[model samples]
Target: MSHSRVNNQPAGQHGMVVAPGGGGNRNAQNMPVDADGRDWSNGLCGCCSSCGTCICATVLPCVVYGKNKHRYQHLDQQGTPEPSPGCCSGSCVAHGIFAACGLGFIFQMVNRGHVRHRYNIKGSGCGDCCTSFWCSPCQLVQESREIELEEQSFGTGRY
Candidate 1:
């Protein structure tokens, strides 16, 4: 009687291609892929690890948020310093005006959505709404770190 062994090798480890007719890994298929294939950074607490950023976030949260917004939107130039992250970016005048009117939070929300889209991060850890409402500073910190991470990882220089 002829005997045959089952192909029990681990997927993607047996020199198997990832295309059709090759070993398929559901886990690998589900991994998020940015333009440069770098994973997104950690959460808001990551800012604390950086002394300067933590201080900035605690002191002038609005300004930090503005920069984070500009970075996330991928605007060019050393854009004007904004008091807030505007609906769009790179315009400090509009940012100042919008912030004074208490509309900066809304602008921040929009940018937060953009960050999520770019990094493919799913909303979790008490949901986006609760996080933004209860701990806006944390959200700002997280976004800032993500922008920094995106730039450092992908060399986008957006931040």
Candidate 2:
């Protein structure tokens, strides 16, 4: 690997040593090294998860992985047919969001319980732009407010 600064400076100019490797001896000038002896690539550095693909590596951390993992788990529970014990947690909401986002159905069965009803009510207005189903109640309130505003405007002959 060829080491260079984020600004594209050669590693040697920044006191970086050439590791004993056949690949290009590249080291980022300002990045921290990790416990595994791998340089902590900057946020812009492209690295793949264990799945061997980096397509969504950066965006997935915040929106698809970590805390979002719970979302996936949630959808899987709600969407599955056979009720798995693991699905009872909040993971179903996350899973449903992930599934709705085109991640595919991880859940074994689809359970259209009150949870799904709430999701349907919320998703109807914005086509499911909201990521978490838990926000359905809030969405309903917002929808009502919007309706009230529309009615008031119409009544005032403002179209």
Model 2 lDDT at residue 123: 22
How many steric overlaps does candidate 1 have?
Answer: 0
Model 2 vs. true fold: TM: 0.18
> Against the hidden reference, what TM-scores do the models get?
0.53, 0.18
- Error at 117, model 1, angstroms: 0.7
Q: Judge candidate 1 at residue 71 and give its lDDT.
A: 56
lDDT of 2 at 116: 26
lDDT value for model 1: 0.52
Q: How far off is residue 128 in model 2, in Å?
A: 2.2
Write out the backbone clash pairs for model 1.
none
Candidate with best TM-score: 1
Q: What lDDT does each candidate get?
A: 0.52, 0.30
Error of 1 at 52 (Å): 1.8
Off by more than 4 A, model 2: 1-132, 156-159
